[model samples]
Target: MKTFIAVLTIFLLSLQCDRFQFGSNQTKDDQAGAVVTFLQGNIFITTQGKESKAKIGDVIRPGDRIITKLGRVDLQTYRGEVIRIKDNSDVLFRDIAGASRQNTDIHLWTGNLLVKSVKLKSGQNLSVTSPTMVAGVRGTVFSFELEKGSVPKVKVYEGAVSVAFKTSPKLIELNEGLSKENYTRLVKTLEENEVVLEPGEKLEVNPNLNELVYLINAKVATGALTGDELSGFVDFENGLSKVNAIVSPQEKAEVETLVSIPGETIQKQIDSQNADNTDVTTQTIEKEHSEKRIEALNRIASEAEKTGLDNEEEIHSHYSVLETIHKANGEVLSGAVVAQLGDIFIVHSTKGVFQLSVDDIEYVEYRNFKVKTRAKR
Candidate 1:
């Protein structure tokens, strides 16, 4: 009878061990602070060295990294703040809290993000950090962009923000427009060296002069300037031209001479030289002029490509392809594009033919899959 009792006790302990193990696994799965409200087209959630395809209602825990490729995702935290991540973006959720939060830090590696925070409880704050700058806010709506080879750009639509450089400790407070009087007061508060951006204002931060010039040139090439902004860009370009001419006097003289000759004249001279038994000196000059003219044409072509028009053919090739649509209200649909009629898109999806307005869609991404049919005997 004592032997029987010993065996029974051992079995009871084994059951308890199994139960504990199950509970531990359950806790790990339940560790989440936010939910993915909307996502479409190749969104992924990576955590603890494991990655999984993201879907609506997927829980986003702290330390989770969200990546979107040719896609966009909208997430809602438990605290009710909304984060909209644009295509080709990677963001890390450093901290997430729902109850009496202290702080939340979001790290943006690249791409753009739109944040809308209605209000933060007392003692709570949120901040976004990029490679070059950090922006802190209590409760606000703002957008941040981290484009390659450019400094971070921040635009505020509502509420105030404090921005600081990543390489330095200095900070500046930017306030949205409360009233004309209040806006004037906030502007007066800025130090001579500090920058405070008002509502509808945008700022780009760069400490390196060369990088600033490149960033401005990129914006101009992309047609992102207007009105006074366009005028300022023109003036800046003229200044750069002057500086280049001063630094390379000989090159400037050569360029001026080349510019005076008509294209037809240059081509005619080349043709004439090719047709004649020209002397070596004249042949050498002809060759040099031909090379310089080709170089100038190539440069113009390169600049035109930078405007993104050269990729028009590639962009249209995927219009009729099958894709997945992620909607703002947490619905996923699979479809092929039928046609686009004005501001609305006609899609033939699993749910049947539907007309979707661009404003209702979060993102649409082409699905990548292959199917094999039986080979003919």
Candidate 2:
């Protein structure tokens, strides 16, 4: 009997440690990707080779792909950055890191995207790549479109973005000893081929030029042009000069204005739903809940700090304080507001991840660490 009791105690301790480690690992993985904030029409997310209709709160991890057909979806990554996947689009979340000086890489196979990126920390990077071209940004609002058989186009609204054709593997395999002089010139030209577009600027990349050596080899085999002539042609075709002119201010506004639609529509929905919430009883209850939420966040923050944990750990600890979201309808949602874009709030709740518009919310009792109340819309 004594031996059995001792063994049971040890077994319980081991199980507890394993449980803790499992929870830790799960949280770390969740921070590595964007979360689906809103979904409309038909959208699918494929993960681990299984595709399912995407729902709010789905985490788009590395290797995951999102397809939107006759629908639109909004995803909020770390620090309030928003990516709006437009209709008839297919995109893959290649990689993401949500830490300070973050890096996010996405592949857009087809369709269009409107991105409202946050101001990036130094060393941060955000990139979108298609089959033939890639666009890199530090911090900017931009639009990216790539349709099959057509050239990829990038349009900048607020900040600068670098657009370039993807380098060819064949170009890298060229023999330096066979023709050192030609090889050196070709490599130098390709290195300088990227174009940077400022605000309101637009550029289209010719996909055929992506494979420099393939083009040159084909031309040479046909005796169409000498290596030297092809080198000049490559330079002319893939030069740093903008292929398309800068869009007009009106056009820039028209493009940039897309970022606001989600927030605006959510507000309209909220206003329509909240029309009956002007009663004294509803106001009283809202005020009480708001006060309680603020108190809960402060207590959580205080307790975590009191435990002598680091800032990052303390932030994680605050997730215990279930946030309250009063929907325009009589329903209430309890979750943590993980990310926000304009007036839309992305909440990680007990039920699931949810994207709620400020207009649809009576109010949000956000975290004390970065606390702010969303006024009743």
Best prediction by TM-score: 2
Model 2: residues >4 Å from true position, as ranges? 1-29, 168-170, 174-185, 211-237, 243-377
User: Please, what is the whole-model Cα lDDT of each candidate in the order they appear?
Assistant: 0.51, 0.58
Candidate 2: clashing residue pairs, number: 2
TM-score quality measure for candidate 1: 0.44
Model 1, 1-377: lDDT tens per residue? 33333443444344334311111221222222555554557899998879999865465767889999978776656565667787899998777654434456688889998786648775566778775455777577667788776677777666766564332111111111123343233223211112344445566443342242343334544555333332222111111100111212222222222211223332333344345532443444345544644454444333323434212132233232457878878898775544432244555455554557788789988866445579999
Q: Which run of 10 residues does model 1 get worst, by summed lDDT?
A: 236-245
The per-residue C-alpha lDDT of model 2 at residue 328 equals 86
The residue pairs that clash in candidate 2, if any, are 57-353, 270-359
Off by over 4 Å in 1: 1-32, 168-196, 207-377
What are the models' TM-scores?
0.44, 0.52
Superposed Cα deviation of residue 99, candidate 1 (Å)? 1.7
Instruction: For candidate 2, give the lDDT.
Output: 0.58
